[model samples]
Target: MEEEPCSLVYRLEQKYLNDDDAYMDQDIVLTNFTGSSPCKMASKRALELVVLNNANISHLGDVSQVSGLMQHVAEADLAWNSIRWECVKSVLKHLPQLRTLNLSYNPLDGEIAVDLPSAPLLHTLILNGTNLSLTSLSSILKNTPCLQELHLSDNKLDFSDDDESVMNESVKTIHMNRCRIEDWAQVVRLMRRFPNRKTVFLCENPIKSIVHQTPVEDLSTLQSLNLGKVELIFQEFSQKKLIQIYNIIDFLDRSFNDTTLEAQVNH
Candidate 1:
């Protein structure tokens, strides 16, 4: 197969260096260049918008050099790569204008401790598939007070009712699907904390434990719950037990519907 275009940044620079009109019209820019050379070039020119320069670059490497691009970026998508917290901290220091960041699918082991330097304006953050513990997650959220949306699915997050302080209400949406969490008490505690949050994706987790531990009437804030693969894996639960769990989920769904209706009517 032909090698993909390697000089994306250079090409972009050449294309719109003199053309003010083209620079002003471009809002998003995506480059699928890995390794060192292209990463260096892309990071160097990330802020120079050829037309109107609202730039967003994705699938680029060289985390060490990303800080330079932060000066001009409005949004950034660094997902599906191999960047770590050190890289994130470095880039965040220079991204004063960055509003959204997606770091999903990166193999980030160890703790997630990042004190965002100038990300007070940041609104959305995606950390899906990042191996972060509950304590580390709490640390990250403490600094990002303006965060609106957070995605933390597919990680080893600790679930215990005693750790209710971890979940923050400022977060409007959370995606924690396939996290192997089995503590219903902790789930209930989380729901109580963020009762007005828009959505929570909890599919492929152990819900049977919730059914046995907590009362069905407790999960009132759940709007869209996903238990699609629960039954397939936990074959020990009898048909009757499964039906009971579904009934509880249905009740929670109805509660969410009532809340939504009330809001609509009030509006």
Candidate 2:
């Protein structure tokens, strides 16, 4: 049998790190590594973050080697790879401390043949550009009992009709940018599914107009909603009303102070 080469290497780019005190404690990053051997850094006890984006990983077995090094990792980025849901399931098995995981731009097609492993501490999951279906998403939600945020940008998620989903109270924020959603009713229905939703990102979606004039009844907990290129802030008065403000400005304007109200509706 051919030996798998050790491709995991410790890396730290100051530009990517933020000013968080949690990161100050023995932060270790392994990025842009090749092959399947992430165990090379197993001796590093303080390994907290891992970045394996675009690492040519195609098989499910490629990520099993990450178990040893990712035992203590809290964050991981495996974007732009050809890995599927099985590979993600394999990676999650060892990350007991994982809080945030990014698997964007991968071919993680629904494949719900088996339930994903439990990730009790995982709160944020980014599957942007992964083409995950609603059924697959519901399947994933069953195990991530504590997930709070879901990012699904660049997927073909058009909630134009009723679809069954697992009700998860833990999800507070959902990002569906560029998801080709056009119906407001469908959007409201999707939002109602996550009873605890606080924020929604619908930028770049094809929703040109709000067909439903009634304010979302179930989303009383929602605080912010992003639509198109502008942001819509929901504030309640004596009579509740949904306000949408549009501001147009020159792309070169450094000041970015130009503003214009395209339209407003009082309900």
Candidate 1, residue 213: lDDT: 52
TM-score against truth, every candidate: 0.64, 0.69
Q: Candidate 1, overall lDDT?
A: 0.57
Clashing pairs in 2: none
lDDT tens per residue, model 1, 164-255: 65456577777777877776555666665554566666777765454435554444554555445555545767777656655755555565
| Candidate 2 Cα misplacement greater than 4 A, ranges | 1-42, 60-67, 158-161, 164-166, 213-216, 230-267
Give the winner by TM-score.
2
lDDT of 2: 0.64
| Count of clashes in candidate 2 | 0
User: lDDT of all predictions, in order shown?
Assistant: 0.57, 0.64
lDDT of each residue in 128-242, candidate 2, tens digit only: 9988777788778878899999998999974544664646789989998888776666777888889888778887665644544445345567666666452332222222223
Instruction: Give all candidate RMSDs, comma-separated.
Output: 9.2, 10.8
Q: Show how many residue pairs clash in every candidate, following the order shown.
A: 7, 0
